[model samples]
Target: MSLSVEEVRRRVAADWNGIVDVLDEKIALRSVSAEGIAGENMERSARFVADTLRKVGVDARVEQATGADGKPGAWEVIGEKIVDPDAPTVLLYAHHDVQPVPDPAEWNTDPFVGTVVGDRLFGRGSCDDGAGIAIHYGALEALGDDLGVNVKVFIEGEEEMGSPSFIPFIEAHRGEFKADVIVVADSGNWAPDIPSLTTSLRGNATCDVHVRVLGHAVHSGQYGGPILDANTVAAMLISSMYDREGNLAVPGLEGCEPIGGLERDVDELGLRADTGVVDSYELAGTGSLASRLWTKPSMTVIGFDATPVKDSFNVIAPECTFRLSVRVSPVQAPHAALEAIQVFCEEHAPFGAEVKVTMLEEGMGWAMDPDCAATKDAETAMAEAFGTAPVNMGQGGSIPFIPELQRIFPDAEVLVTGPEDPQSNAHSPNESVSVSGLEKDVVAEALLLDKLAHKPEPTNL
Candidate 1:
């Protein structure tokens, strides 16, 4: 059975109040899954998700697995709504864990309470994935019993911590996670009225480089003129990675030409204000702003080790270490990029300083088919809800698990979507989700489900 636009909108409007209330309740859970938080919070969050799924006729339960570290993984809410024994199954994925609030004082409203101010809801985890949970819940509520396909609701509890047990959990319960389509509602949108179907995600890797100039610290006035400090040598190493325009000068780390041709104006997007960059600061790399943000490679010094000002006594440092967080193209292998960085550091050793490289971590990038049957149906549904076609976009941030999921289920159509907009400051102070935008997301998803149920044939560009 096909549902009309008017029907979908009416149902969404009727159920919106409960949806917002559920999102608010989730935001207050404090289900942080960082390195050192208590484990009970994750369990509590899992229970909450399982209970919510049951309300919508899903056979849900809480499950957990052991990680590679030989410890318990975060609790995962796993369940299913099998409308028919022989129908296609769609998997709804979202994370209930949140990034820890760095400083509560930085927030205008309480970090855990979802407060509606004007058109936005302000709180931690308000948009990042809380809205995502609500969208999945709201769609099921709107569609009631005529769901075209079966659904498996997998609400993870530790996505913010890199999904350490995700693969292992799948290994333990692979059959339940299988589906024809997977909707990952964890990325962002282009605007409140405009949707963004994320088609690409950059891969990520990190490394630490150690530079040793002197065996031990020495008086600056005595040896400073003849020798360079290790700190200064480390600075030289960082500069060597970029050219005059600040584009990456390293070879062997590949970057692809821009895809989708989606141009972005930095000023209108509030890029400067979002980053709190200084006035007249020139942008790094060469290309359209969209290309730089999505398709190109970027490396930044995330951590530095050196003497502090309070401990400074005008001494030439003996050795120093700095960490580099690298973002590479979806098509490039992260290990290859990390190897290139290591080779560059060894070759460009400033002043012949002894160098050591330790590759920290790496995650593969991903690219999705924009012309698939499910993608076309999603575009049609989102257009009907928002009165405009969704833009095909790419996110620089890496999800890591998407690649693994695709590898396990090669034929499944993976669609990345979310309610976050440019103003949704996820992982920062004053994070929020636009109320109107979230409602649109619910309607769009409900409509997409209706289309997928009826149009099961494959379509391509």
Candidate 2:
């Protein structure tokens, strides 16, 4: 017997506690894959993901692939359950790893513990992608054996580490992954209550710039007057990336045009709590709020190396470095944007302070064809699941693996959907997901899968 959408929703509601318990367990894994850390619990998390999928009726297994650096990457939980040979297959994708907690003391609650307070479930990966695993599980469990389409699951374990081995792994096993539709449960909605289909994603480009101003260290008290310190020169270079108005001044960088009927009347004041901006701090940049976040290039000096105030020294440093992270427009190439930044940095060098740049990470962005038949179906499913009209939105974040998936499977229609909200604060301390929104996400995915199963033949569907 085919399970109805109403039945799926009811099952999601009935099994909400189980879903939370699974999420909490996943959170407790400490599956952090960041910096050079290989994530101690990555294999365990992958096994747990595979077991969860197996229990839910999917034939799943844990797999791993060697990255370009010849090092083994994180474990991948892969499986498939084909209902019909001729039916279109839908690929369900999520990651099983979480980000490292740089400092647990900054969090209001334990970063590895899924603490539920009111409607929010707080944890490091609760909203980012751990909840994503639960969403897929809930949908499959609720649907039972009545899916109209085949399902393939790929739970990545190194997504938090920029998916270093994603390309090689997918290419090595390319034959195992061919789908008519791909659902990426890694992006969030417009708001907690507003359901959104992520239509575009900004790519990322990063580089570290080093500035040298002195040949040797000197006493600041003795040589501070005539010559500027290395830290001061590095600050000047950083300042060149933006204008006095606070907009990024890097030339040749790209910005996407605003979408029609999609420009939001942003309530900056209303979002103060979400942003946690300090009092009297004004927002920067130009253009619509949505455009600024989703389309245009945004740059920040994420890390700086200089002197430590506590380890104070009267010495003038000879060199300093700052790492710049850029989110390029979805349509712009990450390499191209990075090249522009390199040129801008060289040309805008202050006091001819021997500036040098070293490229770090670069990733291509992705955009979906919102007019596709699968997208149309997804909209209806989300609308029904949430009882409100859904919106097509763009995420400012970068999902490097997505564009690669599109490139490999040119025929598949990819959908970026998830349970995160603006307040989720993914990748930061006290990260969380809205409990109610997450429940709706389960229902939405189930409904979307059911709709795809019953759709017409795979003709750009």
Candidate 3:
């Protein structure tokens, strides 16, 4: 029985209101995984996902996965419906956890409320992973129990906090998570109108470096230029990470060239970032700005501790601390890149200052070779749903869990996609997702599942 794309699209359209209702429930839960935040929301969010799945006819369960520290981590929702033992299995993956709302006052709507205005739904997690859940749910509902392929739903709860327990969780449940294909709904597209298949993702690592120049604070008038200030030493260490052109100077962490010539309009990118590059200043790194962002490793000082300027008395600070946020190329191992960073800091410590570097967390990057039958079918499904050809793009951000999934399911074909556009502003104030985009992805995923059911089982290549 050939399933027409129009039929699936119609089913998705009919289920639009129900999908949004589910999304609203997900957004309402403040499922943040940051330190000091209540774990109730994360637990509730996972339960909500399992309940949503079970309500829709899939047998679901909420299980807790321990973090790297061997303590209780986020709740994981795993659901499965075996329609036919002989049929292919496809796993739908997403995260229920969300980033913390930096400031609720800065948002036009409450960050926890799913507010709809125009064609967009605004809330924390609205676009990032909330849309992922809704997409999977809507698609599964449209297909009902006879979804052609056997289906499994896995929604993680601590992705925003680096998925520290993901590997352990997968290892403990290896047999239950096997699949022919894994559709990860946690990436964004090139535009609202254009669908994109993310083919590469940058790796991520973080470290805290503390520099101390003196045992105690000294008066600036008495010490002055003779004394080496910790702030000056910290600045020197940071500066050494970049060369004259502001490219990462750390050795042994090489970057890969872009596989596809992906380019973005600087103006559109600037609009998305909410900041514009000055005409006088040259863009950093080598190659096109697209490659620099998507393929090259980049370093940023995400946090710094120093004396407040407002409370300034002329004083030479005793110490300074910096949180280094590093993005490595998809081709580079995160551990290798982290080692390079540590060595660079130690070698460049200025004025005999005491420098201590500590590794916080690291996640490997991934590059998907989209030559498989499953991925091709997904590309076609997305094209039909979006009314345009799908583009293969690279995402600069890290979905740390993806690499782990790939490692555990080595033979399974993986496709990364989401309903977010640049304007979604995920992880920022006023985060949102397009209503139309969600609908399109729902139809796309449903169609892909339908197509997979009819195709030959993927070979274990």
Which candidate ranks first by TM-score, i.e. highest?
1
The digit string of per-residue lDDT tens for model 1 on 351-442 reads 89999999999999888887788888888888898888887688888999998899888899999999899888898898999999899999
Order the numbered candidates by lDDT, best leading. 1, 2, 3
Off by over 4 Å in 3: 29-41, 67-72, 210-228, 259-273, 276-282, 310-319, 349-356, 456-461
Q: Quote the lDDT for 360 in model 2.
A: 85
Once superposed on the true structure, which residue ranges of model 1 sit more than 4 Å away at CA? 35-38, 263-269, 456-461
Sort all candidates by TM-score, best to worst.
Answer: 1, 3, 2
The alpha-carbon RMSD values of the candidates against the true structure, listed in the order shown, are 2.4, 3.5, 3.4
Alpha carbon lDDT of each predicted model: 0.88, 0.86, 0.85
**Model 1: which residue pairs collide?**
none
Per-residue lDDT of 213-247 in model 2, one digit per residue for the tens? Answer: 88899999999977788888888787778888788
